[model samples]
Target chain A: MREIILSFPKQFKIGFKAAKGIKVLGNFKKLLICGMGGSALPGEVLKIWLKEKEIKLPVEIHRNYSLPFNVDKKTLTIIISYSGNTEETLSAFKKARREKLKLVAITSGGNLLKICKRSKVPLVVVPKSYPPRLALGFLFSSLMKVLTNSKIIRGISREILSLESKIKLKKLEKEGKNLAKKLKQKILLIYAPEKICVLAKIWKINFNETSKVPSFYNCFPELNHNEIVGFESFGKNFHTILFIDKSQNPKILKREILTAKILKEKAVESSFVFLKGKGVLPKIFSNVILGNWVSYYLALEHKKDPLEEKLIAEFKKKMKV
Target chain B: MREIILSFPKQFKIGFKAAKGIKVLGNFKKLLICGMGGSALPGEVLKIWLKEKEIKLPVEIHRNYSLPFNVDKKTLTIIISYSGNTEETLSAFKKARREKLKLVAITSGGNLLKICKRSKVPLVVVPKSYPPRLALGFLFSSLMKVLTNSKIIRGISREILSLESKIKLKKLEKEGKNLAKKLKQKILLIYAPEKICVLAKIWKINFNETSKVPSFYNCFPELNHNEIVGFESFGKNFHTILFIDKSQNPKILKREILTAKILKEKAVESSFVFLKGKGVLPKIFSNVILGNWVSYYLALEHKKDPLEEKLIAEFKKKMKV
Candidate 1:
């Protein structure tokens, strides 16, 4: 597992460096940060932090191979790839360029970098070192900075100053008592209502990979209709139903709280984790860092390493993917 | 359960009524259907049939209230509501109106019916009876006819003619003599590719409500990424994998077969249901109906009625939805 973790860092570090070099934003019609796979976690982290902030323009994170067909000149397309070589990002970049979209790019030295250089696009070139998954912080921070510069939303570096202390290996080990211990008997059901819900997915994956437990994520309004009914079958299998609650709509919030109470009557176990967020960076960073805590504690309970996904690498290799 | 089964027909007959009046789809940019719950099943059926026929006109199915922020003119929006009302569909109808999207509707006569009537949008008012779940056929046939009239896709009159007798329910009843009894001893996994996978999901749901068994659904490519590893974990637990091999790429088909072999090697029970589709409609129709047959057989094995989902209805009442 350690060897597997070590191999992806080179690609990730490049993303980190690029994030550090970005100019902050102050305002925009819309902000869309596009990335996929491990590289996209950073964009997701940014979304979690911005979960509560009042932003005028919709901040979106696109993960698919093409730009949103709705996007136009007023939209800002953030082309991101840790290796600067993701095919989907490149395809979207081409479309964004064709649409004359306002663009910013984050990547290492690869096709993405070359394209950015050729086109004179705002490029954040990171140090080439780790895998995209590990470099989540780097990619996310860059996007966060850019959003701040555009004034699409405010940045919460001061609120998240504690983030620097919390992210380290030693701090995670010590703060195990502070965060996610509340989830010991809980089943984490993450909610991200924003377009793409990048951070919400990250919470689910981390719960699976780190905690080795069944976890799920859903975008808002969508979950309101079908999955809510699914709770009827849960019949007390879970101790807690953690809503990665973010402020999407006041009406939605009221509905969600009512829905939670309704389920508490039937669920064998139920609890809510009201996530605390400040700005785009802090809100998302807080969730990820807190998730990291909860998952690690869960690992301790199961007596398993939080880092182990015993068969994933072997499965990937066998698939020849 | 017996009562529920008897009630499906009345709800389904709404389709026969809806076929009476509908608009032609001329100068329409694309067709998008907005539906949720039981009504959505028919649209899924139509999409798979269309794809099987290589019908390539862009068709979008909105399973939620919000349209993908990109839809616009040249787009035809279809609102389907068996009960004549679905909140998400209503919200979407409003959006479609705002976007000036061409509108055609299918409903028994609810708010959606009233709205369409007051407006110039054409409405195919299906006779509303039975539970929406049982009315899947009517929606499929009516939508197919409208799309056919617009030259969006070829007509399915022959397909409808064939559907009357094509569901040789006894065929699966025979398969049950051998395998259905064994399903009780293992976990059931259902696989379907994106194009026509509704049958796959339908199959799983039927298993859940009928046999009351645990089942899982994995779309291809995505499954190739994560769930392939899950099969390796069963050192001793009884498990079964069902591969719904429909129209998949040869390479992908090979990958699925290989996955089955690997599961078998890991001491898991697995079966392959090789589906032969005469055409797109036959393939989609046969698989969906096959799902109904499989559920019946499994229910018979358990001495349970295939139509018992009282809990699902009870849930709707509790949610006040």
Candidate 2:
């Protein structure tokens, strides 16, 4: 886990070259990302990142078996399975092929990799040492390369290379430890602006997997409409972390502040983290790295192994039978 | 609350004609439904419904300020604000207009309605008598009408009309009350198959609003990959309600059963509600109606007012300032 966190910046460089030999076919009307768990998260992050950059094409993430009903010749489907063996993703990849949709695959060396190779589908191969959840940097950067190659996004490699020196891990760890202290015994309610709301979800997943804690996330503007009402009954068992990106729409920013204030009045502890980084890529990565540290520190505080997922292993084992 | 629940079937009929005078323009490349809370829930339900029927165009739901970056001339943007005054929906409406996207509005007479009127946008006005959450029938049916008229979907109105006679509310209420007894004094983790997952979300909202409970939802196949792991640490405080649709992907149905079994091994109580309806529309509505009764009965058992949303009202009041 520590190695994955420390090597995040390096993964960007590795990911940049991982897809060098693959050529992207442009003119797809939509992009469908198929994966589950950690593999699926980067797609969501990319969706918001693309939205923040004002990209015009719709990006959809499908976490289940089969491609969306809308998958067609005009759709580009990317199948991601870090271990290369996730059943749902394999199902989706085969369905995408049967439907003859343009396809890409990202994996280490599981069945997904073998199938892609046999089918002559484009593939991006990353190293397989780390757990899928900790390999966000490689997954996200590879996806960025695909988008860049397809001409859907431009000049991300420069931003990604700059991120190596820009992110300060030690400082993030200190901040994470401080925040973990406050969040130790509390149920977490993470809130973020809509553009970067995926970060909140990432945080929830990190907390769930790493710290073995129950957490939930919601985005502002939307949460303001309904979930804000929910905080009234939650009491002191909840602590909210608001991910505030200054670049978000001013109205949403105001709502975030007001929401924190309301949470305080309702006696629910709350804190705000202004998103770091000048560009969307950096901002998203910065928040993700910070969340990783937070969840790790939370695990340490709880005396739990950050890498353990016994129940998940058992569930998968049971499914195999 | 009782009036709204008992008249849900009638609301579907009322919603069928809610947009009679409005003409839908065809040939849109994408459908973007913009709303929040109850207004937004229908769009999610519609997305799944369209998927079930194999509609080829992508349908996306936008719950925050402004439309998705993909909104264009070929995108059909529906703005729904039951009260016509929701700030986020209003913001999206203006943004859609500025972008010159095709527009439609569904609302009671509020600021959204007036603006749509002045802007000459096609509008669908449902009755203003019920709380927005309770007005799902009207919103969903009106949306179905718009989709049918635009040729994005076919034959939904007939299914919705048939729902009136097919759905037995009294029986649903009894089932709901029985489930509510089990769910009382427990945190809820509602699970559903991906196709009808919106019902899980509707149940969460109903529980939060009516019973003042903290509830969360995730769909099958996806949950099997991650959230099922979190259940190990969730303790006995959490009770899970699995909404099982018989027609879901066979693998997903197996995962749902296995997930319930795993939860039992973890000592987390769970119960399954097999969806009753034949088609996606009827099935979704059946679960939603039953969820409504469950939440209502939960409120009654807890001696709480099901209709009250004091924190939300207060939050809105503060936002206006």
Candidate 3:
């Protein structure tokens, strides 16, 4: 039996309260989130849930080590570091404070907390104890609360609650009823736009680390330009192409639909999963729950034991550098 | 033995001669090439080569469907489609021409030819036979001839001869002799300014198509800020990390070395690939030659014929709607 590692989720009340407690910070021009991996998933959820919301400022995620050189004081940066010690987030926190941009931070503890204390930036302390990846729901909901309170987005609370409940509808993936399990022998290609892309990325990472499967995620509109043509060669050996389609610009949306359809006809097997939701948080959460459950099922499907990551652990131990 | 589809390149002189006879215009403020896999490699080669050139016009290769929205009349757009049918390139070409930007075309034949002919723009045609992947030397040399004629850069004759010799070096790449073969299961994280990132991207595409590996190319100091930290978690599942290190600024150079060392410590496996050349054409061609040889060798290592592409053929036959 594979050792599965996951805590029975705490009463979803913590996330619910945090999501309900978001407050508006007046005068921020753009909502910028500087985060990586699990911490960043929340921003993606918010963006996707709020796709229809008239976003006044472009919300950009800084996944690299530094912020774009052109950032100005008008930017509202939310620095996310699970350990609070994440180096890149710390670098960005210092830079944001140096420029005196408005700031917020999410973490249990680390240099982020220290810097936020020194700089007097607002802090939202998440519950510590679990891996950062598992903390995605809380982080994502909190970020959504902030966006909604700031009026950059409206109506996300119900979506979060809705997603929390709907996840049960996907059969609570115990053992045999898992879609992700089927993906074990195949490469997982998660395709989506800005918000969904983050969820997809998180899902890919989860599959890689937990299941030890090589998976990938990419954004749309961009993929159509180069990667679409690439599939002309992927053939039957290529198992699946999953498109997490949400609402997008009419023309670009059509391009995606047409391309996915063309690829399906061209390839041995492909899947087009169109998803919809009331708010960004809910919609992103919707995909997150599906991916999470499916990957768990996939873990069981491959009989790889859902819990062990011997390769990653061994690599880390050997490298101590 | 597996069935052979695409064969090892046999005759190359005609391709080389055709490449030697093209011309590029020189009045624009910036050079932007609309390119996909085949000729895109040349764009990257030129970026590296130009760093050492006597006179250099800043060049950008738009790899996606949309030209950077910042593009305008001062941009000299070169649309490159080896088969002359890439949709993204065509889209950008249409937009560039519609905006009245000066345009040039490199293609064998397709709508690109008609668009250029009817619009009175110049077109340089190559013989359409070999895989676009194998035809990089011809395309790079041809583009160089154009740039040289248009007075964008100097030292073309020498560059072509160098490219020719380099292509010869890539033939029948065998085990220990093929550098590219060793890079399988590695990442080509290229770091350059947006202008030069084109070169790095070409290296990545070559690895993906020719070598069948996962590779990445990104520009810096943007990378300095973000992606560098990913090494901490990358620990060791990877085989290597190759930086298409070019001779550039002293500050950027120092940062790159430090970044590589940090990544090396963090990576499971890694190495640095330095690019050497005296002008735009030579450097670009050199990298391509090295990459091509490496990939060919890698294909051989897998005990599979390098030229067979059964999947892509099937994709063409089955894709519909």
Candidate 4:
């Protein structure tokens, strides 16, 4: 797990290389990303990134067994599965094929890879070793390369390489440990602005899978409209971590600050973590890397194996399709 | 609150009348509904209803302030705010207007109505009095009528009217009271199939607002991929409500049953609420109405007023925008 965390930058380079030779099919009206669990997280992050970049093309993230009704020939459907064996993604891939939508596959080698090979769909294969959740860098970079190559968005290869060189993992680890101590034995309620909402989700999933804790997230403005009210009855059982980006709309930032005040009044402990980075991708990945360290420290505090997903294995065993 | 619950059916009739005379602009390439909180719930319900009826036009629900970048003149944007004063909806309405997207407004009366009136946009005015959360019937019916009148979807006026006549609120209240008794003092984790995921979200929000509880929801297939694993460390602190419909895909149904079995093994108490009704709308409404009663009863158990949203009021006062 530690190696994977440190190797994130390297994964991006490898992902870019793997994405090479894959033909760009431009003029697509829409893009659909199909995956579930960790595999789906990258697509979600990319969706937000695209929105922030002001990319005009519509992108839909599908986590279900069937594709959306409107997915047609003009739609570019990207199927992602770290193990290439996720039932839901395979099901969606089959449906996408039947619909004859333009298809691409990202996997480390499983049934999905075979299907892509047999069907002549372009494939980007990442090296397999880590759990799917730990492979975000590879999965996300591959998807980003596909989007850039297709002219759906501009390339960020140079920026990614620079970010890799600039990131200081030791510093992140120290900060994560400090925060994890404060968050120990408390449920986490993560909040972020709309543009970085996926980052909050990543934090929640990290805590859920790594620390084996029940953590949840809600985005700003939207939460201000509804979930903020529910905090009135909250007690000390939860601690909120607000991921604040300097670029957030002033109104949204005010809402987040006021929301923290409200939660404090309700006796819920909360703190703000200002995200640092210039570009959207840098800011998102910076927080993503820091979240990994926080969850890792949390796992240490809980005395649990950060890499083990026994329950997930049990679930897959029971799942027939 | 009791009056509001019983008046659900009557609201549909009034809403249908209110929606009349609102001209529907046809030939829209896509549909976008912009609203937040209660107002947004109806759009979500309508999206599912449209999917079940196989309406091919792509419908996207936007809860944020800015319009999607893809919203061109051919996109039909429906801005709904029950009070017509929700800041986010107003923000989105202004953006949609500037983009010259086909615009429609549904509201009782507030800034949104004024904007629509000044802009010469068609408006559907439902009656005022109840809180927006309690105004789902009116909002949903209004949106449904717009789709029907626009030739985007077939009219369900007769089916809705029949449902209004056949619904037995007294029986639903009794059932809701029984369920609420079991659910009191416990956190709720609502689950439903992909087709009815929005219903699960509604239940969570209803619990959050009315019962003053910290409730959350996830849909099948998706939950099976990640969250189902989180249940392994589950204690007796939470209860799961699986909203099951017989008409759901067989594979999804099996996953739901297995999920329930796994939860039971983990000592997480769960019960299946088999959705009753032949049509999608009827089944969804049945669960929605029942959820209202359940939350109301739960509020009574918590010694709180279901209608009093002092915290939300405080939030609005603090929100500058």
**Which candidate number maximizes lDDT?**
2
Off by over 4 Å in 2: A24-27, A150-152, A231-234, B98-100, B150-154, B231-234
TM-score ranking of the models: 2, 4, 1, 3
Q: How far does residue B269 in candidate 1 sit from its true spot (Å)? A: 4.6
Q: What is the DockQ of each candidate?
A: 0.12, 0.60, 0.08, 0.57
Model 1, span B111-153: residue lDDT tens: 9889888986788876555556556667777877677666666
DockQ, ranked from best to worst: 2, 4, 1, 3
Question: Model 1: what TM-score?
Answer: 0.69
Regions more than 4 Å wrong, model 4: A24-27, A149-154, A231-234, B24-26, B98-101, B118-120, B231-234
lDDT score, candidate 1, position B102: 76
Tell me what TM-score chain A of model 2 achieves.
0.94
Candidate 4 lDDT by residue in tens digits, B257-297: 88888778767788788886667777888888999999999
Error of 4 at B124 (Å): 1.8
- The order of the candidates by lDDT, greatest first, is 2, 4, 1, 3
Candidate 2 or 1, higher lDDT: 2
Pairwise lDDT winner, candidates 2 and 3: 2
User: Which candidate leads in TM-score?
Assistant: 2
lDDT of 2: 0.83
lDDT for A83 (candidate 3)? 77
CAPRI class of candidate 3:
incorrect
Question: What's the lDDT for candidate 1?
Answer: 0.59
